[model samples]
Target: MHQPNYIILQCYGYEAVFLECAYALMSLSRLYKPEELTNTEIWVYTDKPEWFDRFADCPLPLHFRKMDAALIKQWRGDIDFVHRIKIELLLDFTETRTGNILYADTDMVFLQKLDDVWNGLAPGELYMHMQEGKISEKGNPLFRKLDTFLRSGKAIKTEGTPLYDLYMWNAGILGFHSSHRELLQKALEYTDSEHPKFPKHIIEQFAFSIQFGSKGNIKSALPYALHYWNMKELRQIIASFLQYFDGKPWADLVRYSSLLQPYILVTEKNMFLQNRSFTEKVLNKKWVPAMPNWELLEKQI
Candidate 1:
């Protein structure tokens, strides 16, 4: 048997995140054949593994690993830096694991076959979700805050030059092989030392960009996946869908229901204002009471 590629995710506190995991897994089932799916493993690191018990019968192989919340709190210092766990997990995989690893946020859906994306990745390469424009002191809002931190001597400087010259990336999805251990270690080092200087929410991405942005190996997976990180309204919709149809097979849900379709349509429209408006419209139209008739909704799809 071929060595399996790992799909990693971290979720805690929010029970609803498990639903996101189910949706992501459903998307994966839609894209991959049974053999390909069998070769892939989904590992979720969470503080509450018991919540995942309900999904024991899911088609995909799911592994739930407990998170060390105490250690996470210590690493975060005074602030609740939950995202720091991502760097720690990446370090663990790169140091201890032997195969290719892909870490994706739960708020994503696979749109197509990922073989091309996986095949495109080379050893020692790190793939990010997408790239934003260059960081600039005069034009960007966050850079001004970063500039102050740099001037204060608290922030550890990158190997060469300041962050203003480097590009920014969305850290929603990251892919790497075990050969990139040193690169992941550097990112962790920056996270440990410079997190206070950067905004807590985005510090991890900044650390990753500082180390890998200049490298030509950084690639984007935007084509194979759709990330709904900014769509708060859509997240609520998904949460509702999952709760309404709890315990049902994801493969059936993906094939028979239109729950995931709205997300694709909104993304295709690509208008922020229009998307928000449509999200609100859907929320109002699809709003259900405490007990929803999921069968009726399923049949409607």
Candidate 2:
């Protein structure tokens, strides 16, 4: 039998936001109806372990960990936060012996069953957030500036380093086999390298792009979940989304603004929930993979 598992990265905070994120995920869990439903293992990595102990008797097998917030504060590299999450996954994967894994962000609600995703895993292949555009695609004005910085000869360098570029990805929900251990190693190398300053989220994304290469090993996924508010283009995308949503049922927003959503999804949980519900509506009753490459206002790196 194919064993399935779920992982989530979280931190304790205001009750409403936590409830919103948990509800969205639990709602998705209810939809999947997995056999291990009574014993489905769910691992949560957080700085606040106490927040999750309340569910000690729940059907979902819950594992919790308290992470050092200082690493995030001091290094703040692109892959730092997620790299830690991946490490948590790596360690848990070794310990739990779960054969298949589905990684999700806490703030998304699943609209359809994920059995297909679980069944689709191929040997040696792992699920990754699809890059929005082609490799050769040049980024927008702000991103161009970021590229300039990378090439400016001022970045921290290490041997075998490759200059990076790639599209954005909203990692709300992704499925992959536990077999792709090499991917995690490669991602860590990319994130740990010296840089003038630590790369934030984009570093891991860029590393993932390079790791997957042109074959697009991590093929695009139909929109399955929505990440809430991201900070990259906090000002513009919000305005554009309001315009894009334009009186449509809030659920239809992602279809219209998928290209811009990833950059804004991680910043605010409440906004993420509100917009995710709206985007879920127009997304072709099935998941719609996000658009890869498009001009977007860049953030300070």
Candidate 3:
């Protein structure tokens, strides 16, 4: 199985950020064999290598590439769009390396083994987490706003890509051959041109979507990885878990993380979408996406 090198672009700052990546990384330790990992490179870009000292023995051999404050600021580029760092990193990787590159966000957790996931991608294809839908059709309040803005013919400088029909793929997982580096540049250009006009946080995501769509074979990485972008409450849960798991070995962390499910995938999220009476649907709202509570989750662990 020929899996590409993986990149996790994160700077050391918040403890929740570290815990988010740490939990996601444990998914690797649990799924891949030691020998398989020996040949694979998991490049972790961060300012603090010591933050992950306890996870040193993980089967996924983490190679730390330090990023200082100035470098990170530069990567954010002139527009100061934070997500642009990912494109810059990909471009930087292609300058020196020739293999395939798989860039994942800190919020993602792998559901399949790395080799098995790699097997599913076609040669010369690109990937994002999954297709959310065309912006014109999406029911999301934010997408609705963007759709209205696009319909008014504001930024016609997007080089004739169908702004309304562009699908908003979640940018949590990106896989592409290193040779396709030019697309990243185009994505950056799209971002720079559109962001000043629209000023939404999702411009970078849509930019990558548009550029990669030009390749004609962008697959969904949803089956292999879960991007818990909507699970905002998880910060507290992860913090509690990190405190509980302090000083534990990598194997122990892997064991528990393997059992842990993304709260967004649980039944509570679905129950909210269930059919309801006209008045009840208008007046009554659900309190939560009820993941297993900490007490119950601890018992399960």
The numbered model that scores best in TM-score is 3
Candidate 1 per-residue C-alpha lDDT over 1-301 given as tens digits, one digit per residue, 9 for 90 to 100? 3445788987766756776766777787777666767667788877887876665655677777777768667645554577777877777655666677788988888877776655655445678889865565334667666656665667665567677667778889987766666777787777767776565666778778777766665788788787778654555566767767766765666665445564654554455445466668667543222333566767766
Q: List the residue pairs that clash in candidate 1.
A: none
- Assess the local accuracy of residue 293 in candidate 2 as a C-alpha lDDT between 0 and 100: 28
lDDT of 3: 0.75
Winner on TM-score between 2 and 3 is 3
Name the regions of candidate 3 deviating beyond 4 angstroms.
Answer: 1-4, 116-122, 157-161, 263-266, 269-301
- lDDT of candidate model 2 versus the reference: 0.49
Q: Residues 135-212, candidate 2, lDDT per residue (tens digit)? A: 234455545555665665765443553453445454444555666555656755655763225445555555555555
The TM-scores, one per candidate, come to: 0.81, 0.58, 0.86
The runs of at least 3 residues in candidate 2 whose Cα sits more than 4 Å from the true structure, single-residue gaps closed, are 12-17, 34-39, 53-58, 68-98, 149-168, 194-198, 213-216, 229-301
Q: Which candidate leads the pack in lDDT?
A: 3
Which is superior by lDDT, 1 or 3? 3
**Reference-based TM-score, model 1:** 0.81
The 0-to-1 C-alpha lDDT of every candidate, in the order given, reads 0.69, 0.49, 0.75
Q: How many clashes in each structure? A: 0, 22, 0
Residue 298 deviation, candidate 1, in Å? 3.0
Give the Cα RMSD of candidate 1. Answer: 4.8
Task: Tell me which of candidates 1 and 2 scores higher on lDDT.
Answer: 1
